[model samples]
Structures are given as structure tokens and as C-alpha cells.
Target: MPSQPPIPPLLSPYLSTAPSASLTLLTSTLGATSNWLILRFICAALKNTSSEDGSTKGDNEATTVVLVSWLRDATFWKDGGRKLGINFQKVHIIDALTTGLGIGASSLADVETEILKAITTAKPTTRVEGEERVLLVLDGLDFLLAATSCSTLETLDLVGELREHVYTTLLTSAADLPLTQSPTTPLEISHTALIMTMVHQARLVMSAKSLDTGVARDVSGVLRICKGAGAGDKAQEGEGELEEREFLYFVGADGGVRVFERGA
Candidate 1:
């Protein structure tokens, strides 16, 4: 198969964080779709190896991506993953929405428990070395907000709990290795850097929404980094801050996601 296209440079910074689970809140208009963006992110994460130049060096361990989706089924992701040239096996899909089948969660707490269990089990333990990074993709928070019948505060609390669980794991087992055995590339260093360098933890949170006024073919939409947990201080020194940035992107005829600065 041909090599997958590189993610647009504008979006690369979001996914280049040290290996750790993180929560990204994706808020979009009722009809606008963010599935393509999620798929693109998965492709980018899986394609990242120890090589900073985007080449395969050393052992090319495939990243494990567990997608807990409340909006779609396994087949939907399997097809999308194939189109992106990503190994479908690396993408695990869990179905959390069951209203259409007439069987739904009995309570909001039950739903929260199920989600937490799925994420906790998906996290890789540090007992083994050279384990690939894991990326947890929660596809539809809006669906959960609606289906659970929970108050806004209650739902937000659940999100907070999920975030804590997802973002606190070992970035990479390589961090435990001796200096003589450390890898040198930026990507490798980010994972296996010294304990001092490991203090900061960053993760990408992207949100997409449709333009209030736009023709169907135009497909105008907004994309922005909600916030990456440990990125604020680092970003302030140079890139301003992640939360202050936003972009305009659209879906193309070929199913590719193209992004452009909102006002540039």
C-alpha cells in the first residue's frame, strides 16, 4: 500500500505529546460531523514510530487505539480505518449507544461505570518494555450527554473522572531504561526523556463545528485545540497558548480533512 499522507503540519503539534492517555472534549454543532478528524488523528498516532523523521526505525511497534463510540458501530470504523491505510486490528471499537436496539443503560451512573471500565482495561501496563502507546478516542460526548439523562453538572463530573483515568498512565516503559540504552530522536526522547523532562504531560483536545451560515457544498467548519493539559506553560513562551488557537477546515471529495487558519 502507498504511504499514508502526512498530517497537515498545522495539526502535528497536537498529537506529538509524551505517551499518556488524555481527554479531548470535541464539541460540534448538531449536524456537523467530527468523525473524519478523529480518524485522521488515529492515523497520525499509529504512524508515529521512534523516528522523528516519520520513518520506521528500531522496532516499529504499532500504537493501540481504543475507540469508545456512542454514535457508530464497529463496521463504520473498520471501513474508515481501511480508507486511511490504518490497520483495522490496531483500532478497537466499543459500542456504547444501544437505544436504537431497545436496550439502554438503566442509569447515568451505570453508563459512567461502563465507560470507565473500558478505558481502564484499554490502558497498557508498564510491566513490559517496548510496549506501544495507547490512544483512547471518545467519539461522541454529545450523544452521551443526551442519552444519560443526567444533569449538566453530573455529566461534567463524569468527564472529569474519565479524564483523570485516561491521562495518568506511563507515557512509555522506555522511561525506565538506563541512559546508555536511551533512544535519541525527538519522538523517542519525548517518551524516554529523564525524569525532570517527564514532568510535563500534554494531550490534544480538538473540537469541530459547522459554520452558522454556509452552503452545503462549501462545508465550512471550525476546528480548535480546546486545551492540552500540560501544554499551557510551554505554549505561553512561544506559541501563545493552545486554547487561543483556532482553524477552519472542511471535508473534501476524497474524504480527506484539510485545515486552514480561520482568518488567514
Candidate 2:
């Protein structure tokens, strides 16, 4: 019966280069929207790529499937905060687990099961000759320790290692292959369109200062990403060339900035 955290507002502007084709992300405050996006992408990619073609068009899927696991609680930190260098009461990880508020955060096993199920759904019949495309949409990854009140740094380390394994073994391996050139004969243009849309939604969530910033900027970003994989595309495609230019401004947490500004 943990209380829900306030859903942050959208701060980033929407990209609108491709109107007819765009990915807009809205959830009932449930974190599973990310899981759904990932699942859908995998399925679509499977359907799109010929089981006979040994190539994947998308990036690493495992890395995309991020999980925020909480291993400790506040009571453990009742003592003065000395281990983590932060106050536990200030940011309760359990609050992120309320089923309705967002995707129910769970343990490593739970996350693994969910991801495995998704992967199974898009299983490749011809392993050596088929490419399975998928993207994981994990948000708020930094909140993994939000609930742990005790010094469960060891547990945190374990989770981090687990994430790396999945990413390196499954996602990275997939990305290493040349799947983009493999023409998808069984999938629809709409399918690829949908996956691209999801990626755009993720970008918006990552870039926005808040959630309610209007889908305008987010939509614009989606279009721009779809039209061109990167943020730099000059075509006045989705919204306008100007909007596309603005989507490049990425503000990371303090002391951590992305290479956006020129010559940074």
C-alpha cells in the first residue's frame, strides 16, 4: 500500500517531422508501458524480418530492456546515513512499485521472467538465419535503490552485473550482426513504423523536462528520429527543420552532459 510518486511533467519538445507516422507514449501511470513497447517491438521485428534472413535491423535489445530492482528498505537506514551518502526517507523506492501508478517494480528474477517471456514470444524459428529485432524501454533506472533502506550495495552490484550480462549476451550480440540490410519480406511497413514510434517516445521521455510539455515536441522528435536515425536531419519532414534542430538539446543530470552542444 505504498503511495505513488508524482508523475513528472514532459519537459522536452516533440519532434513532428513525420505526422502520419509517429510514436506517442502515454500510460495509465503503469511502468509496464515500457515492457509493452519492448514486447511489441520484438514481435514486430520478428514478423518483419524473414526467418530465413540472418540479420537484425535494430540496436541491442537487452540493453534496452532495463529493470529497476529494489532490494532494501527505509528501516534499514534508520541509523544516520553513512553508507549510501543519501537519505532513504527522502526517496522511497517502494513508492515506485504501486501497481496502478506505474509498472510494478520487482526483483531480478521477476524482471528476468518478464523479459524472457517477451523474448519467447518473438522466438526465432531459424536461429542461424533469422534476425529478431527488439528494443527495451526502461525508464527511471536510477531508482533501483529507491527502496533499499539498508546497505545492500552487494545486491545492487549483482543487479548491475545481471543487466550487463543480458545486454552483452543478447542485445549486443544482436546489434553486432548486420540486420539492417536484410530486407523484411513478411513484415508490414506499419510494423517498422510502430517500433520507430516507440523509440521516439523513449527519447521524449528522456529529453523532456516534464511529462505535460505537450506531445508537440515529443511527436516532432519521433518524426525526426524516424526520418533519420540520429538527431541531426535537415529535411523539413515531420514538424519543421527548426523543430528538428531543437530536439538535439539533451540535458543530463548535474555533472553529466551529453555531447550535444558544438565542440563540447
Candidate 3:
């Protein structure tokens, strides 16, 4: 396996914005290659915020991550846990693909219900003070959107609900209120509240797809920030126009995801 690439610094502007809700869509024709890469990225990111014991350190904050996958099995993630040094105990994985075996959800509705339950359970509440964060990862959204049992509208509605819930919960948190009511505060001035504000202003949509052109050694696809959010001030300089940014990436021998500009 190729060594995994370092987390793209470009993502820092987005991921560092805690207490903000953002949705990143990973798509590819490479049979879950992009999904796996993204999963690894998230695990790596979360691991940075934790201690050697897997407990969150500093910031008095906790991140609850729930992954809903209609593909792969526990074994797949188990491998990731070992390689990434991630404590799976802190991550909730829901297998939604198995059927007739009494192991997974039976239908689309069942899947939705399970996801909702997971999100609700993982989200931080008033009982847990301090900065609470939730990261919900939905793998195989294309499958759900294409399933005959679930209408497109229904799928979209579910995503909308999830986004709204995440946004509301994070924004209403005591630590985040100043970002909304006191925009001039140090935190607000420093754009500490930028991510939350972005989440409130628009939904983020990202897509990953295979590119026929070679981007780098062993690299096969490009990821694009298609809609919903922008590159912050840089994007705003376009006179209210948001320009889409694209990146070419590949999974290295170490199972790490490496990303770079399309032509770089």
C-alpha cells in the first residue's frame, strides 16, 4: 500500500471551524475508493484532537462521529481503526446494507430511522456542557438516492433535516452564541465563527469523481467543492460570486489520502 498523504492544509480553513455543520459529498466511479479515502481523512482529523488514550484533550470539547454505510462491513473499518490509531469505541458505525440476515436495516425507512437515532444519540446535549461536536458521515448516499423504496425528495428532505439539526444544535451551544449576537467580539473578528456562519448561510456540497487525466502518481480522481459554501474572504472578493475549487487526489500506499490542486 502507498503511504497515506497528509491532511490537505486547504481543508483546515473548513474543518477547524468547530461547532459548525458542514456536509462534504464524496463521489467516484472507482468503487468506494473515494469513500474510503474520505473516511481515513476524517479519522485522522479526529485523532489529532484526541489524546493517546483516545480521549479528547484540551478545549474541553468532545466530538461524536456517526457513520452510516450501506457498503462494507465492520472488518473494513476495523482495519482502518488499527492503521489510523483510531479508537473505534468513540466512533459509531451503522451497517445498512445487509438484508434478510437480521443484521442490517430491512428497508430505506428503516435505514433512515436508524440514522436519525444514531445522530440524535451522538449529538451533544444540554447535559454535557462545554464545546460539543457531532460529525455525521453518510457513505453511499448515491445508493439511497437511487433506491426505488426511497423517493429522491425523501432523501433530500432527510439530508436537509440532518443539516438543519446539526446547524441549530451547534449554533445554539453556549460557546457559539457570541458568533451570532456579538459579531464584533474577538472570536467573531478572528473568524472563529466563520464556519458556523457559513453553515447558516448555505449548505456545503462537495463531490469527488474519477478524472481520466492523470493528476499525479497513482492518483485517479478529482474532488470539487461544487456548491453551498465558498473559500471565505477569498471567495467573497469575487463580488459576491463563489468560485468552485477542484483538487486532484490519490490514496497512497499507506492508505492515506493526498490531495493537491488539479494542475499542481
Number of clashes recorded per candidate = 1, 42, 7
lDDT of 1 at 141: 47
Instruction: Give lDDT tens digits, candidate 2, residues 1-264.
Output: 122111111111221111221222322122111222222222232222332232334323222222222222323322212221222222222222433122244464454455455444433233443333222323332233223221234323433444333311111101101222342632222223333333333222222222234333312111111222322232345434323332222222221112132222
Ranking by TM-score: 1, 3, 2
For each candidate, what is the lDDT?
0.54, 0.27, 0.51
Question: Which residue ranges in model 1 land beyond 4 Å of their true spot?
Answer: 1-6, 18-21, 49-62, 98-105, 124-132, 168-205, 216-219, 226-244, 261-264
The TM-score values for the models, in the order shown, are: 0.64, 0.27, 0.64
Clashing pairs in 1: 21-167
Q: Point out the higher-scoring one by lDDT: 2 or 3.
A: 3
lDDT of 3 by residue, 1-264 (tens): 556433455544333332355454443444225554545545544554433332323332266667666566667776765675666665677766553211334555666677678877876554666456667766655454434445445555556677665432211111123334465744343333433433334434445556655444567566665455433433433323333677776665556666678567
lDDT of 1 by residue, 1-264 (tens): 223354655766654443444444344444556777677667766675544544323322436666767677877777776777776656666775543221263566765677666665655555565453567666554344444444445645555566565542222111223321465754333333322232233344455666657654545577766554555545544534344468887676566666778556
Best by TM-score: 1
Candidate 3 whole-model C-alpha lDDT, 0 to 1: 0.51
Which sequence of candidate numbers ranks them by lDDT, best first? 1, 3, 2
